[model samples]
Structures are given as structure tokens and as C-alpha cells.
Target: MKRFLGFIEKEFYHIFRDKRSLFILFGMPIAQILLFGFAITNEINNVEIAILDHSKDATTGEIINKISASKYFSINQFIEQEADIEAAFKKGKIKAVLNFENDFSKNLVKEKQATIQVITDATDPNTANTISNYINSILQNYQLDQNKDIKIVYQIVPQTRMIYNPELKSVFMFVPGVMTIILMLVSAMMTSISITREKELGTMEILLVSPLKPFQVIIGKVVPYIFLSMINAVVIILLSIFIFKMPVQGSLFLLGLESVLFIITSLTLGILISTISATQQTAMMISLMGLMLPVILLSGFIFPISSMPAPLQIISHFIPAKWFIIILKGIMLKGVGISLLWKETLILLAMTLFFIGLSIKKYKIRLE
Candidate 1:
């Protein structure tokens, strides 16, 4: 019994002394609980929406006021005409647009009913559905409150039009997110584990001492993985189109180019991980824990970023997967070209450059 107690005490001391073990035991749970609690939410707050009021009447004004008063929505803009709605959605700022039909108040009073067309950008079908439901609820509550004393009960009908995805297919949303995750995790894990394996087996020192330069070494290490990742991407896209009937509304050439760029960005990030990590296990752990979680939770893949807390939303901007997912959705669903997608494309390019520079610097330090 005494020897067994000594062994248990030694195990406790070993766990406490290792910083990584301490973090895995205590820090990870705390961080995961906080991230899951805040990020995994169905309710949306301060979602940006626009209004197109043709009536310009008291009834429309009151309804707009009521919508603006709620914390669920923030009136981003008041659109002028019907043609502007498409442009607004392509710009990727407005989620839903409330278009009040002409002669709203007069029709309500004369015909005892009125119709409000709810046009939603349904690239993210869940959010579109939720926005439509919230608006309908508001209209119902308003109708009930106004008709309490009247003999003829007034009705406000919401005709919801889900553009881009009328059927609200879950596959439309999942494909882009899954593709982003696969590219990021696979590319990163492949390169990170490859380089770290060389280090673990003592072959990296042989390569370092060779005539090849560090940049050349890095490029050679990543080139094979880059080709493999592109093939994986093409296979995924083909499967999505052929098996699932997913449409590629935009240019395929442009999609291929953007995918190559994201793959490079992910590979460069992996190289950075390899430089800092001493073993394949550490690199794999970092790739899974550091990259996978952010890609799933913070990339607006599973949940709306506008619905997350302010800090998480801000942190999401740094995530490359977030921008790639946006780009994929824009091309696949909206048929948006390079003009509308330039900003996100540029962001991914900049991240690629930043990661490349940092990885090279780290590699040079390790060489020294």
C-alpha cells in the first residue's frame, strides 16, 4: 500500500510539472466551455436588414419603427427601388429586406388586409428562415394589438421569398463549410506532419545541411502537398455537383484559382506549425485543436457570425476559413464575379503572404 501511494504521488507530480498536461487538463475545458457557450446559439441579434417602403404611410412607418425598435434587427439601410435589393444582397451586408406593398395603409383600411413581401438572401437558409419567422411574429403581434377593440380584425400577411435557395436545401450550406474544413485541416495537417516527421526521424538535419536553400526546402516540401490538396478540392467539388446536384453559378476557373490560393494559405500555416513544433504529434494536435475548432465555430459555417458575441465576431476576421467560406457561398449561390468578391480574395492573399513570411522567419531561426 505504501509503494502504491508513492507511485500515485509521483504521477500527480509529473502531471502538474508538465505545462502541456496542465493546460489539457484544466485550461482546455475552460476555454472550450466558454467558446461553446457563447458561439453555439440559434438566436440572432442586431442582424442587418433593409426596408423598401412604397407606401410611405403611417402604417408602414409604424411597422418599420416597431422592427427597428427590436434588438433582433438593425435597419442597415432604406432601399430606394426593387432593383437595388439584388445589389444589396450581392454586396453581402444586408440579410433580409422588407418591402411593403404600395398603398399599404389604404389597403389595410379599405380591404381589411395588407401584404408585406419579405425578401431574404437565402445563401444561409437557416438564417433566412429565422429572419422571416421573426418578422412574421412581429407583424402578427402588431395586428393583434391594433385590432383588440375593433369589430373587423385587420390582417398583415407576410409573403416570404427565399432567393438563391428557394427550397432551403441544407446541402447548399453544408458543402461549402465542409469543403473549407477539409481543405484547411487536410492541407495544414499534411504539411505540418510531413515536416515534423522529417524532424523526428533526424532527416531534417540532412536536408538543412544540403546545398538547397531554406525557401527552396520549404517550397519542395509543400509542392507535393499543394498538388494533392488541389486534387482533393477538385474531387470534392465534382462530387458535390454530380452526386448532390449542387450548382456552380459562377466561373469555374475563378473558383479553381481561389481554391488554390486558400490551399497555399493553409499550407503556409502548416509550415509555420512545423517550424515551432518538435514532433508530429504536437503538430497534429495544434492543427486539430487550433485550426479545426476555429474553422467550425468561428467561420460562420455552422452558426451566423453576426449572432456571435462581439469579440468572437472580431476574432473571426483573422480566420482564413471564414473568408474562404464566404467566397465559396458567393460564387456557388449568388453567382457573384470577381468584382464583388475582390475584398475577400485580397484578404486570403494577404493572409497567405503573412503566413509565408512568418514561417520563413521561424525556419531561419531554427536553422541558426
Candidate 2:
């Protein structure tokens, strides 16, 4: 018991003595939350749109007025010629261009309708779609107001309810993913590098020749990291719950259990990495470049899998971080139970077992 406490105290010194890493470990979650909350949002507000009104009549003027009055569109430019529209977009000034057809009032009175073209830059598709929808909503509202006195035979009203995120807040999607990535980095990457450091320093040989079993040595090394990562997870959850006002609708106990499972899975990966890497530098590099990038890009963390190419989407299935993040979101945001997240939980367990099995095999080979 004394020896274990001393070992834990040594681990604490190793962790706290490093000022830079300590700062990163504690500071990163707060920084990431702020960045994702304020900066990287999907919601569009006051998007700049240009107007190209070929018609100078009442109908076109009214439509333009309605668009300009709405909060979504800020009409920065009124292009006289069609040529200017391309130049404005080339300069990256405007996202959309609303063009009213020639003789809009005449067509509306004579033909009972006027044509308006919405030209959007598809380079950033989400923003483009939002701008287009905003314009459509303004027009539809104006039409409804104008036709309130007249009777229509049938009206098709489309009702929408956002299932996962009612407010369409990207933070709701990001908090779980960010939490997963942070835990993975701190537990897996840091532990891997630290273990490799022991090997590089000739300390592993001394530990191996000691009375402690190989598995026990590895467990002792990783146990402190597991506790640290649990602290990180708790801190992140508290920030998300209190600061962001995000809810954990599912069982808190279940969330903690799943988190521990994921931490163990990540620790197994760290062990595998340590077994493969001969040096601390190599371990760190492998963890950052190989694990972190794939976890971020392919894990459906920032971008939706549905939006990716078929090949990348297929590749994402193998990333354990992907499954863990999905489970976190299911439990945290959607308040889903074990019934919904069982598949992801099973996949994580399988990954953990696979990594541990591979590491054991590799370690035995090294021993022989």
C-alpha cells in the first residue's frame, strides 16, 4: 500500500512538474469549448446578399424591400449590370445574388406570378443553403401577408422538428466529440509517450527484472493516467453542463461507466503504441499524426459522415474514436439509453480487447 501510494505520488510529480503540458491538459478544454461555441457555428446571421433587380416596378421593389427588411439578408450592393454580380462574388464579398426578372410587376398582374432567381455560391454549401432559405422565407412570408384577404384552394405547410438539435447549435454536437478527443489525447497519447520514455531510459528493464509482473508494470504506469483522464472528463462534463447549459438526459452513472470503458480502451491503445515505438519521440509523433488526425477528420467529429465521400465514410467505421463520440452524443445530448448505444459500446469493447491482445503478443515476442 505504501509502495503504491509512493508510485502514485511520483506520477503526480511527473504530471504537475511539467508546467507546459499541465497548462495544456487543463486549459485545452476551456479553449476548445469557447472556440467551438463562439467561432465555429453552423448558424448563419446577417449573410451578405446582392440584389439584381431588372424590374423597376412595384412588385420587384416590394420583394426587394421585404428581403432587405428581414434580419438574415444584409443587402450590401445593388448591381446594375449582370457582369458586376460575378465580380462581387469573385471578390468573396457576397454569398448569394437575388435577381428579379424583367417586368416583374407586369408578369405578376398579367400572369399572376413573377420569376425570381436565387444564385448562390456553392463553395461553402451550408452558408449558401442558409442564405437561400432565408430569402425564400422572406418571400413566402410576404406572399402570405399579401394573399391573406384572398382564398386559396389548398396550402401545403411543411413542419420541421430538428431531432438531435432543436436550436441547430453546433456546440451541442461538438461538446461530446471534443470531450472524447481530449480524453484520447491525454490518456492514450501521453501514456504512450511516457511509457516509451521509460524504455528509452533503460528503466523498463529494471522494472521487468523486478518481482512485478509485466502486466502489473503496465497497469501501474497506466493507472495514474486513467485517474487523470477521469478528472479531465469530469471537468469537461461540468463545464458543458453548467457553463454551456447542456443537459445529460441519460443516466450519469452510465455516462461515467462508459467513459471509464473508453478510457481503458484508449489506455490499451497507448500500451500498444508504447510496445511498437522504441522512443518517446516516435510514440508522440505516432499518437499525434496517426491517431489524432484520423480521430478528428474521419470520426464524424466536425463533419457529418453523410457529407463525406463513400470511401472516407467507409474508412470511418474502423476508428474507435468515432464510435465513442457517437456513444457520448447519444448518451449526453439525446439522452439515449443502453438500448440505443449498445452497438457502439460493443465496438469499443472489441477494439479495447483487440489492442490489449496485440500488445500482449508483441510484448511476449520482445521478451523471447
Which candidate ranks first by TM-score, i.e. highest? Answer: 1
lDDT score, candidate 1: 0.92
Per-candidate Cα lDDT values, in order, are: 0.92, 0.76
Stretches of candidate 2 off by over 4 Å are 1-157
Model 2: per-residue lDDT, tens digit, 258-352? Answer: 99999999999999999888778768867876677677767867654434545666777888898888778767765677876788899999999
Best by lDDT: 1
C-alpha lDDT (0 to 100) for residue 323 of candidate 2: 87
When superposed on Cα atoms, how far off is each prediction in RMSD?
A: 1.9, 14.8
Per-prediction tally of clashes: 0, 0
